[model samples]
Target: MQGAQRNSLRLLQWMMAASLALPIALFVFASTISYTSTNDIADREIERTLDVAHEHALKVFETIDRSLAEINEVVRGLPDDAIRAREPALHQRLKRLTDSLPQLKSAWIFDADGRSLVNSLVSPPPEQGFADRDYFLAHVDHSIGTFIGTPLTPRPPYQGARFFGVSRRRDSDDGRFIGVIQASVLPEYFESFYARIGSDPGSFFAIGRTDGTVLAHFPRLDRDLRLDPTGPVGQKIAAHPDHGLMTIDWASDGIERRIGYRRVAEYPIYVSAGLETSAIRARWYATIGQHLVFGVPATALLFLLLAFAFRRTQHLQAEAAARREAEEALKHSQRLEALGQLTGGVAHDFNNLLTVIRASVDLLNRPQLTEERRQRYVTAIADAVARAAKLTSQLLAFARRQTLKPEVFDVGERIRSLHDMLATLLGSAIEIAIRLPAEPCLVNADAGQFETALINMATNARDAMQGKGRITFAVQVATTVPDTLTHLVGSHGFVSVAVSDTGIGIPAARLGRIFEPFFTTKQVGHGTGLGLSQVFGFARQSGGEVTVMSEVGQGSTFSLYLPRVPPDLLPQRQAPNTAPALAGSGMSVLVVEDNIELANFAADGLTELGYSITLVDNATDALAELVVDADRFDVVFSDVVMPGMTGLDLAHAIGDRGIGVPVVLTTGYSEALAQEGRLGFELVQKPYSIEELSQVLYRAARLRRVRDGAAE
Candidate 1:
């Protein structure tokens, strides 16, 4: 009788376990179906909304362009004087034309010189000229088809209107460029329409020129907003200029979105529509939540049954916990692997540079070397030093940790000066073109790093073109940085230096990783892959950004945007100094460095430059020496990183103790210097030439003397 009872209990326990498993398995199956179907429905809805936006953009732009074409034909053979003679009639005609089209805010006719001849907004249009405007300049230079320019606020007398130019080039009978005929397309029209159709929460709609300039957007961004050409939406347009779909984290609002984009047919414009991923996920959650409501009660009942078989349930729960822990450990291991890969690449390149230097040194040690042989070894060593210095600078720039010395200067002048240098760098096979606006574009940044960034980009262009295509450098003024550059969205304005190449374009798949350090597509030994990385870091560090646009077979354009400084901020230009190279005469320098070899090298170099040098191993010893006879040294030249208190600390200590000597800090790399900057002291970067060292020391020493003389 007891054995029978035991068998019955075992059967009941098995029945309970089966029941628990059955409900959980059914719940999992139901959830999988619900989640998949929910995502599908969301995707379809997003695509449907995108289709509507695309069609709306097409109709609006087509209507505007068609009207402009009709106006072009009306004044086809009329000269500027003839158009002016009939100004009243022409203005009335334009006003009527604009009134007929809800898309157009106004219309204007400009002469060859861009003087407003007739406008729909006002009769005998205001005495304003648009000669400097992008739309006018674009048509004046070339006979491109319909051109849609970036958004701009109308000047006085029409300042209330917000419009972008939709222009067509006017040509005379002889094909000479006459002037521009432009329609002032109201962005508000597009915005209103977008809002009506884009009713979903977190939906986005944008109309932009092919060049990534935002002409209009829904949810209304600043009028000056632009799009990053290297971002996901831009890449989609580049890869599929006609139409495409993409999933990306939208930088404008920091939302992940599923987007669809289409180009306005035969026009330099594109339109995009997107739905937020978060919103889509919410729908999925809602659908799944409904299932959970029913499944939860069933699950609770199953748990109660499992309590009768608590031993089996405990074993399963422990296994699940172990699985979770293993997953976490694996994720940590993967992160370490990624770190190791980056470090390994850095180590490899550094080792190669070091090997070259080591080999050159070993060869130079041979006794009684011939002049030719000795010169070759010395040249090799010099080459290695230069390459190493460049490598170090690139690394620092990529990390955005380089100490920058910023000054307000004209970027156009700098580019003009680099013509000869760029010519030499790109070689004879490549043709170079430069386009500079009449007005100077100025920015405050480290001029040397600016030049380096330009050179790096040009070099990349040259390589992409296989050393034989035209590279154009164009400088333009921009009112706002791209909104997709999340970090720089609120920047007041920017000056864009664009480098374009007629070379093999970058692949869309590769564009996202192009700025990562040591990520390269070039064959081994052909490139270091840090060129773009350096450009990226330098722009960000300088309060700006760099963006790229590339179509697989149609070449590429890389643009560097820097914070613009007004012309008023430019420092007065001083006459060039004609002083002799030995300019450090009579200045005494206290060299503070922990490394004996480096200290001796600097001391000897400064001494050769006509400066008297006193050497010390650390800041403490240098302070001791300075405390003894403060007037003995004109300047203290110190290495920033040292064994004890850093060089920066010493500079502070010197100032705190009333040491009148000026401190000039030097370093190859220092986190503190990069973060806090020069700290009111002169700074010279490492691997600097003797001439550079002399100039900095002399300037600091002379400044000190002048201050001391004033006190006396």
Candidate 2:
């Protein structure tokens, strides 16, 4: 009986082991297969999304191109006499052109003299003259076929809204240039086109000029928004022009997104489409969850059977614990990634605000005033700008977008000059130490930004110590890492600057994210979460790297490794200077600006400087004024943005009208309008102080005078 009982016990144990082992092994195998299948599904979904985006983008480009091509064909076929006749036949032809292609808002022909010959939307005898339009001159070259023109406010004050023109040369039957034909498309056309590309509220599309000026966006967001792609993923997209997809936190919408971007390889413009990652990943989660639901019950059944036979629940429990740990880790990583995106978005907006403030302050300083009052205003402006400067420095540092203005400089000398400032910044509660090498170290970097970075790091160190601890900054040149320091050395040729502090060391959980933007332990108002990010950015931008070492009780050290600057390239030093005095003989000028206050100010300022001034509210009035005295004005000074006719069109009209006057274009936001090497005239960016205005006017007048003298 005892032998039989023992045999039964052994058989039961064997059965229990098999039950536990078989299902779990099967579950793992099934799970692995499921995961691989899910991965493949995700990849296919991404590719499909990309394809849809690419197709939509290409359609927009083709639509614009085809619309322009149709207008060009009509223009080439029409005779100058027929277009110039200003009869019902001409109006009918123009209307037919627009009717056939609804995308075209209006179409018109301009005679060689810059006068509107035939317009689709206007009465046959249209009163407007094109003698001063940029498009007229831009198309005159003929080499630039089917080009996009700057945004144009329509001609004749009460007639049209803002539109962009697509122009091609109008050639006679004999191939002689008789005139130019243009198709003006409204902003609504682009808005509608972008709208069709993406319907998801979370997905947005933007059509921007090459210089980053956004022309149109679907679900139009704020006009003030700017996109900077200097971050790791942004850099990758820019460097690789091929279509690609990635999950990134979009700072603009404050959402994690799986963005797919493709450069319109055929068009001069850059357009991109972005979709929310949540939307794309939601499907994957649902599918995975369904599988998990079915598998979990089966898994539980297997465990129960094993428990009944073998009494070994501990092994099963251990495996569950391990899976939970992995899931937690993945969630944490996702959170950090989200936080980095938020930081970048905040930084971009902050930088734009700083730019506006800085430009305003710079303008304020150019006028003459009483010494005491001027000194106060200057100091106040400087102080405010200094704070703004800190934000920009941090942005550049974190984004690695800081423009390098490198020159040879003695790093040691620069640091020594900041000793007094450091002492005040550190305060009496904190002890400070500096270790420098005996030899001078030269570095190539932007000095102002470099100084600001050092000060920021020092301030952070002071805060870490809670205003009462020791901080040491050591700078040295070493051939190799000493055996004493195995924990913080890397393989590279470097000059090291180590800032160590005896304060609360970073928690192990947060250590990995210490350099991420906006990952802060400080109270809301106390930090922007950009300090260390900026430090990391600056180091990388300066051809260096940063690393941190910390232990809970042992404190922490932040080390920056900067590559030594080559001897051939050193920093340049500049002496203080003032703007050169305006130098040119007085000449007649036309000032076209919509803002009454600004227009009056500009006209008065120009008149005071002894230049003859003609002022107008829009391109129509400017053309009328010029017709009255076409040869009187030496230059046309106009604002780029206006209610009816933009400054660019006004410039083109000036050229078209057979007036040889030069143009000095001005704008508050000229990025969208100004095309480098194509304007055929000068540009003065707005909110301009008297001095800048005078200088630009002077340059324009001088150039015109020289040209006239050559003609003589």
Candidate 3:
């Protein structure tokens, strides 16, 4: 009887073990299958999305290209001047054609110089020129058929609207390039369609130029983005050319995805679509979670297993949260450290300059100072002040806050002009090589800043080479900027001035931080570390960018990209206005500045310049004076930033109240000035020399008189 009871107990135990083991095995197998199936589904969906995006992009481009062709035919054999002369009829005709196409926002006819000969948007096209525009530049030298350009915000009165250009090159009877017939395609049209088809939040669709310029994206990116040709998707496209598939972490947003891409026929355009990896994994989890409900039979056992899983999930989520917090803290600390470094560097340099000025001032004030000694002290003081100003200027450049004076100039010529100077600076040990295109590479930018940027790059290269390596400067027209500099690339093209050095290369670890202000690898006092920062800022401020490539032993190359100016537009380059700082000719001026010292300084300077000055410390007080006798002051010179009413407000109020005094505004730095620009008022930046102030005042007073004379 005891043996039978023992046998029964063993059988029951075996059955219980079998029950748990069988279900656990089934759950594992089911989960594996579900995960694999989910991935397969995701892959199929991505390919489908890619097909849809590809087809949609192709149709849109084909339609627009057809419309562009029709417009091109109409304007065929007609010179830009003739089209400009017949703008009225041509504009209406272009408008009708553009209106018929849902994908098009507008159409434009540009001369070889990028002048908007006529556009469908407005009558007379707002008197604006597009000589520096990318689409115009692209079609200028190259005869790429049905060229598609990246998205760009249209200039006011359509400022807030975004459009991409589809342009065809126009040629004269002699086969010389004349201009372009471009259709302004609305990117929103494509984006909206993509959103409708790919509604999943993880779904991404994009249309880009083969060269990597993003024309449109489904998940509307806040800023322009580009795909790196070196990245997985770009490589896939390069390999397949027509169609390809890959799983990659997209460089643009750092999202891992199962993606597919296709080229739009023979055009230089590509369409891509993808589903996020995380989303696919989530779908798999949900599927397996459902399967878990049926896999477990015993309620108590299932409850316990779920509880364990729930705890594990909670622990994992907590760990992820902690990691995220740690990362945020690290980033915040890094930012603070960078701030400290920048401030310390600036303070150190400024203090040194201040020390020189202070010592010079003390010596100048000394009793019985010799005439020669006094002059020497004054010169020292002046030199220190100048150095201080230069330091401030460099800081502003790195911050991209300095006002720029941009002009059109041939970059090739400028480099040629700087050859002797650069050779001298680099020393005889360094061999300098200049490589330029046969044609001139013209760009519109601050020539001084451009020169400074080049000098900074050369100086950096010299240091890397230990002042004894070959430095080659090359200038060429670039169709696309590097992916890192996508934001700065123009839709038309860029003029790349690459400075290459055969020297010890920058390490990968420090490459990204090279542009940070005051960040350097040099020994103490060797480098201020603002050279690369200045180059970065100047490039960005000039609507371009700087990119670097390096390998440990191979050396480094730094490329500064500036938007190209068409050679045909060279004649339109405005000559430097060197207005003589003549006497103000007794013109009455109303000066408005809150700072007492600045107000007095301006008053003294203007008085010396033969202007009768009425000084008011605030805009309100200045307004009160202006209201009393609007015609008494020939011009109102006011600082933009002040207590109570701002200079901008005061100027508006004066204009609203019919004050005749022409308002000239000034500021050290104001966001309003930086963003909205002069707002139709003449603006003079602060720290202006007396000569500059005099010239501005004289110009203002003379302009007011001319207006008054015309009114009379």
- C-alpha lDDT of all candidate models, in order: 0.84, 0.68, 0.83
| Ordered list by lDDT, greatest first | 1, 3, 2
Taking all chains together, each candidate's TM-score versus the true structure is 0.51, 0.35, 0.53
Cα lDDT tens digits, model 2, 183-277, are 77665665676577566545666555544445566666544344565764557667776656666776555677655566676665665666565
**Could you tell me the TM-score of candidate 2?**
0.35
Between which residue pairs do clashes occur in model 1? none
For candidate 1, lDDT tens digit of each residue in 610-694?
8898999998999999899999898899999999889999999999999889999999888898878898998888887777778
User: How many clashes in each candidate?
Assistant: 0, 17, 3
Ranking by TM-score: 3, 1, 2
Give lDDT tens digits, candidate 3, residues 187-218. 88888898899888698888888889888886
Location of the lowest summed lDDT over 10 successive residues in candidate 3: 571-580
TM-score of 1: 0.51
State the lDDT at 247 in candidate 3: 86
Candidate 1: Cα lDDT at 333:
97
How does residue 573 of candidate 3 score in lDDT?
58
Query: What value of lDDT does candidate 2 attain over all alpha carbons?
Result: 0.68
